[model samples]
Target: MKKFFKLVGFASFIGILYYGFITYPKLDLISGFSAKSIASGHFIDHRSMEMIEKGDNDIKMIDLATNTIDENGQFATASVYGLKERKAIYREGLGATLIDADFDISAPYEVPKRTKLVSDKLFPYGNQEAKDTVFSSVDYAKLNAAVSNAFDSTDKKDKRTRSVIVIHKDRIIAEKYDTGFDKDSKILGWSMTKSITATIFGILEKQGKYDIYKPAPIVEWQKDKRKNITTNDLLHMNSGLEWEENYSTICDATKMLFQAENMGRVQLEKPSVFEPNTHWNYSSGTTNLLSYILRNQFKTHQEYLDFWYSALIDKIGMKSMVVETDMAGNFVGSSYSWATTRDWSKFGLLYLHKGNWNGEQLFDAGWAEYVAGPTKGSKGDYGAHFWLNAGGKFPDVPRDMFYCSGFQGQMVAIIPSMDLVIVRMGLKENPEFDFNGFLRGVIGSLKR
Candidate 1:
């Protein structure tokens, strides 16, 4: 019996060694990459260091102190503060770099003016001047109660609501934040970045730069079976690419997010497992691929940066928004975008106004309708990139509602019928928060 136990222990040691040296390298890289990126973004955006440290508690395989360095000291070393799992470099000019494991490939990166641009213009709402008119029509008592409940964590262990903002008729009606967060805090919008990617595509389409119905301009698929796949298929997540979206393990999503220096190239190489536009599989790879295609539309990185700035961010006044790029310098549309709660609301407002901001059409005419319209592959639950409220998914909310949903309970729900936009951002692994019930409560509180 003692011999048997010793053998079992030896076997366990071998398994650990195999996983540590082989299977776990990607996972470790993902953790370090994410931690370094988050730390860099926070420091660059002037976020609280204490809050940033606390946020790292939920991530696996992360050593906050070792992985993160002071903002001034990050650029001096090849690795971001001497982190393991390859050299995750950080530079003041280029944010965090997800270096390849072999250290052979890294994209030419530049810090665009948009990254440092902050409009000095005052916000339309949330200031003392707008406060008087913003909540005048809202039921003060009921709206207050609803907003309070959204931020409350009385009996729920996983209900960490960071920020909640309710905009009614284009005015901020109610807003609340958790202890460590505020209106100015820029929160990460994981999968919600996909919707933003779709918007960028729509803007390009408006300018006649590309067409979704045509074959995607991916050189890899030019001679392959995937050559027939259209930009529309990628936007709808029906590109038929075989992608494992598992976040708990080191799957395609993690590989694209962390290990791959050229995320688009990694995803583009994926062979089709299903017929194009025939199946509805949520794929971060498709989004990243779309971002890559978008990048190709421009001759230089500066042109791409200028387009994003002048086209979307500047038009909607999303001044606090920051979209990060992979090592290949393509925006990681699948994940990695940060915006304040109000900035998220502005994004929702753009959708609520049918892709128009202040009477200027930011995208093609009827682009909003096309995006919110249900995809046949999704059975009315998902549109182009946004999640739809159709198919009885959110029975309490109007069927016309569409949302930008992200991992860990981030949402920017736009209810067009009600002229309402609700923004909720949080960091909960298993969310106990009820978005439907919360939206219902907020709608119920409206005086109209």
Candidate 2:
């Protein structure tokens, strides 16, 4: 009996060693190589994208450029890259990836190095006054204390935070990044892309595009009752589309991220879950369909990027922005937008000021009000693509606070009553969010 037990133990030890030392090293090698491509400004292959969608490395791609691989294994200048999203964040390297990748890559065109701090102008919305507020600085010590307390109280071990920035009255009041990362890191925004997508649609409405009162511009709806679905319903997550947002490997959401070539199109093909505009089901499908509509409306990716950037991101001077691409090259509107911490703050401030920054009306005056209005799910408080602060009567924070939150922990909380914008970025899974606690603490710590 003793000899049998000894043999079993020996075998188990060997197995563990093999997986830890050999298997993990190989996995890291692949991840490392993918990281190299990002650093070198090379577009990562689909296989790499699959790895990221599975949350294998925590590192995800924000941009897919046109590139050709040759016999010598080098990327040339024929490829032109377009900025896609507003704030991009990386998953792995635990903040180590950005710096490491930066050191290795060589590009022909002057690629705007991803940094923690970025500034750019948005179209028709651009103004000198807005630029000033977008670049404002904050009190770091007090802000750090708040974030540190929030993190320490959490139980998750790998709770990595890449960046955090706070904005007040359109000025960046505080900005910070984890070790091994600076303002240039293009971290993935995950579902936060939904809010950004909503912004684009808002701009489209301003441009005389389809009105929210009318049926959505989806082609599939014209033949069926889905035609009753309105753009307003989609924006409020009330499209009644059938979709399971489960992140399981085979679930529709994960599959869209990992396996589907045209994520937006795939969602459009799915049937409805409930009556249009009646119920609120948090479906990525609505955002995906929005992408399809944008693609159908616009001529090309560059045109879409140009229109939005000139009108929105560029106006606010947000740099580190890069939107992800689907297999069809359309911006993945559901998930995947990347940017630095500071750049994200710019977005938060833009919305906080009711689409007006530095004396310029970037978005329709009603845009912020629409986003801050609640939806059917929240008993009429969560409106459009943003989340409002409910269950009021909290300290330091006002009852009317709202925010644009993304997967992991990318957040842009806007406290309208307090004239404050709080941005937090990190990795935190659902059914276990520590953000509310953090928000409470931050409000508690604010200088009274």
Candidate 1 lDDT by residue in tens digits, 1-448:
9999999999999998986676445545555555555555555456554555566334554432243445554421123234343445565434555565565334445665653334443344223224445455567788778778776566453667888988877777788988767878878888999999999989888888789999999877888899999999888888888889887767888767766778877779988999988888988988988888888898988887667767887667777777777777777788878888998998998888887776688886599999988886788899999999887687777888889999888999998888899988886632367877777788887756
* Model 2 alpha-carbon drift over 4 Å, by segment: 1-144, 150-158, 379-381, 391-397, 429-433
Residue-by-residue lDDT tens digits, candidate 2, 162-275: 567666655555566765456666666767788888888777766777477788877777998888888888889888878788642245675565446577877688787789
The candidate scoring highest on lDDT is 1
Report lDDT (Cα) of residue 274, candidate 2: 87
TM-score of each: 0.87, 0.70
Q: Global lDDT of each model?
A: 0.75, 0.60
User: Cα RMSD for candidate 1?
Assistant: 3.8
After aligning candidate 2 to the native by TM-score, how far in Å is the CA of 295 from where it should be?
Answer: 1.6
**The 10-residue segment with the lowest total lDDT in model 2:** 85-94
Clashes of 2: 40
Give the distance in Å from residue 82's predicted Cα in candidate 1 to where it truly belongs. Answer: 10
